[model samples]
Target chain A: MSKKRDDIIDTTSDLLERQGYFATGLNQIVEESGAPKGSLYYYFPGGKDEICEEAIRRSGASLEKSIDRAMSEADTAAEGIAALVEGISRAMEASNFGAGGPLTTVATETAGQNERLNNACEEIYESWRATFERYIRKDGIDSIRAERLSTLVLATMEGAIILSRTYKSTEPLQRAGAELRELLEFAR
Target chain B: MSKKRDDIIDTTSDLLERQGYFATGLNQIVEESGAPKGSLYYYFPGGKDEICEEAIRRSGASLEKSIDRAMSEADTAAEGIAALVEGISRAMEASNFGAGGPLTTVATETAGQNERLNNACEEIYESWRATFERYIRKDGIDSIRAERLSTLVLATMEGAIILSRTYKSTEPLQRAGAELRELLEFAR
Candidate 1:
C-alpha cells in the first residue's frame, strides 16, 4: 500500500485504540495523519467504516505476528503466553494505558450495531485464537483442549487489558499472566 | 429516586451497554427513555457524564447482587462462577447479543479520556473484584491467591463478554466459564 494509506491506517488504529470508533472523526484522522483531506476519500471511498475496517485488520495481523514470534521464542506455551502478556503490560504502561486492545473498544461498541465492522472484529479475534490454538497444540495438547484453552486465553487477555487500562495499572495484566501461565502448565 | 430518574438511568444503561458513551447522545436517551427533554438536565445537572456515571453504578450494583445471589446458591466458588457466567450467556442471547458487560464498553472507551467516568468504572471493577476475592477466600484460599484469582476471573469474564457479543455467540463465555471452573477446582 501507499505510504499515505499506511499512515492513515496507523493513525486510525491509534485513535481507535484510545477513543473508540464513533469518537474518532475523519477530520481528526486527516489532521493527525497529515495526509491530504482528499486522500482519505481517494484511498477509502467507503469512508470511516472502510478506514476502520482496514485499521482493525492491520492491528490484528500485527498482533498475530507478535504472538507468533513470542510463541517461537519461548520453550513452553505457558512461558510464551506469560511473555506476551508482560509485553502488553509494558506497552500499555508506556502509552499511559492509551494503547493495547486496538480492536476491543471497536468490537464492543459495534458488536450488534454495525455488521461490517463487527464482522471484521470477529474475524480478527478468530485469527488470534487460531494462532494461540496452533501453538498450544504443539505442546502436545489435544485439538479440543487446545481450542478451548486458546479461547480462554484470548478472553482473559482482552478482559485484563480493559481492567489494566481502566485502573491505569499493570497489576491486572500481570495477575492475568501469572494465572494463565499456571493454567497452561496444568494443561500440559 | 423518582420513577423518572430511575427510568432515565435504566435507559441510559441499556444504551451505554450496547452503543457506548459518545455514540449515545442525550437526545437519543431522552427520546428512547420517553422522559421530558428538560428532565434529563434536571435530573443530571452535569449532563451526559453524570448520566453515564449513574448508569455505570447502577449496572455494577445489580451485577454484584447477582454475583452475591449466585454465590450463596452454589456450593463451591467454581460452581458459583459457572452459574454466574452461564446466566450472563443466557442474558446475552436473550438480548440478541445487545446486552452483557454494561460497563465494559464505557469502561474501555473512557478509560483515560474521561476522568470522572473512568473513576466510576474503576470503583465498580474494584467492587466486583472484592466480591469475588471475599468468596474465594472463604473457600480456604489464602488472601493473596484469592485476590489474584478474583482479578483473573473478572478479566476473563469481561473479555469473554466482548467476544460473545462480537461473535453473536455465547460459546466464548461458555468456554471461559468451563476453563475458570477447572482453574478454581484445581485451586481447591
Candidate 2:
C-alpha cells in the first residue's frame, strides 16, 4: 500500500475503534489521516464505506499475524490463551482503553446495516475461531469440541475487551482468562 | 420519569443501541423523538450529554430488573444463564439484530470520552456482574469462584451478542450458552 493509503487506513481504524462506524466522518478521516482528498478518492472511490471495508480487512489480517505469533510463543494451548488474554489487556491499557480496535465498534454499528462491512467482520471472526480451534486441536481435543471451545473462547475474549475498556481495568480480562484456562485445562 | 422525559430516554437509548454515541446527533434525537424542543430542554437542560447520561442509567436499571426476573425464573445457575442467553437471542432476533440494546454500543463508544456515560456503563456492568455472582453463589460456589465465573459469563455474553449480530444468527449465542453450561456443570 502507498504511504498515503496506509495513513488513511491507520487513522480511520483508530477513529472507528474509538468512536464507531456511523459516528466517524469522512472529513475527520481526511483531516486526521493527513491523506490528501484527491489521494483518498484515488484509492477509495466508494467513500467511507469502501475505506471502512479495507480498514477491517487490513486490521483482521494484522491481528491474525499477531495471534499466530503469540500462539507460537507458548508451549501449551492454555498458556497461549493466557498470553493472548493478557496481551489484550495490555494493548487496551496502552491505547487508553481504546481496545477492540475498529473491529468491535464497526461490527456492532454496521452488522446488519451494511453488507460489505458485515461480511468482513464475519470473515474475520471465522478466521479467529479457526485459529483458536487449531490451537485447541493440538491439545488432542476432539474436532467438534475444539471448534465449540474455540468459539466460546473468542466470544469471551471479545466481551472481556468491552468490559475491560468500559471499566478501565484489566481485572475482567484477567478473571476471564483464568476461567478459560480452567476450561482448557479440563480438556487436557 | 415524565412522559416527555421517557420519550427522550427511549429514543436516545434506541439511537445509542443502533448507532452508538458519537454517531447519534442531537438533531436526530429531537426529530426522531418528536418531543417538543422546549420539553427536551426543560427535562434535560444540559442537552445531548444529559440525555445520554439519563438514557444509560435508565437502560441499566431496566436491564437489572430483567436480569433479576430471568434469574428468578430459573432453578439453577446453569438454567438461569441458559434462559438469559436464549432470551437475548430472541430479543435480538425480534428487533432484527439490534441486540446490544444500550450496553455494548454505548459502552464501547463512550468508555473513555465522556465521564458521565463511562461511569453509567461501569455501574451497569458492575450490577450485571453482581447479579450473576449472586446466582453462582446460591449454587454453593465459593465467593471467589462465583465472582470469577460471573465476570467470565458477562464477557462471554457480550462478545457472543456481537458475533450473533455480525453473523445475523443465534448460533454464536447458543454455542456460548452451551459452553457456559459445561463450565457450570463442572462446578456442580
Candidate 3:
C-alpha cells in the first residue's frame, strides 16, 4: 500500500474510532490525512465506502493480531482469554472511553444499507471469532460450543466497550471477563 | 413533555435509530415532525443539543423499561437477562438488520466531542446499570460485583444487537445468552 493510502486509512480509522463510520466523511479523511485530492482519488478510486471497507478489515485484522499475541503470550486458552479481555480494557482506557472495537460501530451503521461494507464486516467478525475459537478448540471445547462461545465473547467485548465508554469506566469489561472465565471453566 | 417536544423526541429517536445521532439533522427532525420552523426552539429552548439530550433520555427510559418488563416477566434474574437479550434479538430481526439502537449509536458517536450528549448518555447508562444491579442483588450478588455484572450484561447485549443486526441473524445474541446463562447458573 502507498504511504498516502496508509495515511488515509490510519486517519479514517482514528476518526471513525472516535466518532463512527457514518459520521465520517471523505472530505474529513482527506483533511485529516493532508493528502491531495488527486492522490486520494488515485489511491482509492472506489471512494469512502471502499476506504471504509478497507479500514474495517484493517481494524479487524489488528484486533485478531492482538488476540493472537495475547494467546501466544499465555500458557492456556483460559489465561489468554483473560489477558485478551484485560488487554482490551487497557486499550479502551488509553482511548479515553470512546474507543470501542472498530467493527461494532461500522457494522451497526452499515448493516442493512451497505452490502459491500456489510459483507466485509461479516467476514471480519468471522475472522475474530475464528481467532478465539482456535484457542477454545485447542483447549478441548467442542466445535459447535466453541463457535458459540466465540460469538458470545466477541459480542460481549464489543458491547462492554460501549457501556464502558458511555459510563466512562473499565469496571464493566473487568466483570465481563470474570463471567467469561466462569463459563470457560464450565466448558472445560 | 409538550406534544411538539414529544414529537421531536420520537422522530429524532426513530431517525437516530435508523441512521445515527451525528448523521441526523435539525432540518430532518423539523421535516419529519412536521413542526413549524420555530417549534423546535420554542419547546427545546436549548436547541438541538438539548433536544438530542432529551431524545437520548426518552430512548433510554423506553429501553430501560423494556428491560424491566422482560425482567419482571422472567422467574429469575438469569432468565430475565436472557429474555431481554432475546427481546432485542427479535427486534433486530424485525428491523431487518438496520440500526437497532439509538442511544448506543449516539453514545459512541458523541462520547468525546459533545459534553451534553455524553453526560445524558452517562446518566442513561448509569440508570441501566443500576436497574440490572438491583435485580442481580436480589438474587444474592454483592453490590460491587453486581454493578460490574450489570455493566457486563449491558455491554454483551449492546454488542450482540450490533452483530445480530449486521449479520442479519440472532446467532450472536443467542450465543451471548447461552454464555450468560452459563455465568448466571451460579446465581441461580
Which model scores highest in lDDT? 1
Query: lDDT of candidate 3 vs native?
Result: 0.81
Chain B TM-score against the true chain B, each candidate: 0.98, 0.96, 0.94
The predictions' CA RMSDs to the true structure, in order, are 0.8, 1.5, 1.7
Scored against the true structure, residue B177 in model 1 reaches a CA lDDT of 86
**Each candidate's lDDT (Cα)?**
0.92, 0.87, 0.81
Q: Candidate 1: DockQ?
A: 0.91
Q: What does candidate 2's lDDT look like per residue over A1-188, in tens digits?
A: 58988999999888888787877899999899988888889999999999998888888898887787787788878899998887888888888787667798888877767888889999999998899889889899999888779989989988998899888989999999999999999977
Q: What level of docking quality does candidate 1 show?
A: high
Model 3 residue A53 lDDT score: 81
Tens-digit lDDT track of model 1 for A28-144: 999999999999999999999999999999999999999999998998899999889878888998999999767999998999889999999999999999999999998999998
User: How do the residues B1-188 of candidate 3 rate in per-residue lDDT, one tens digit apiece?
Assistant: 47877898899888888777777889999999998869888888888888888787888898989988987787778989888877787777777767476887787788788888988888888888788888888788888777767877777887788778777888888987887766765754
Over B1-188, each residue of candidate 2 has an lDDT whose tens digit, in order, gives 58878988899999888877777888898999998788889998899989998887888888888888888788888988888887888898999887566778888887768888888889889998999899889899999999999999999988998999998899998987898988987887
Q: lDDT, candidate 2, residue A32? A: 97
Off by over 4 Å in 1: none
lDDT of 3 at B93: 73
Ranking by lDDT: 1, 2, 3
Q: Give the worst 10-residue stretch by lDDT in candidate 1 chain A.
A: A93-102
Candidate 2 DockQ, CA atoms: 0.77
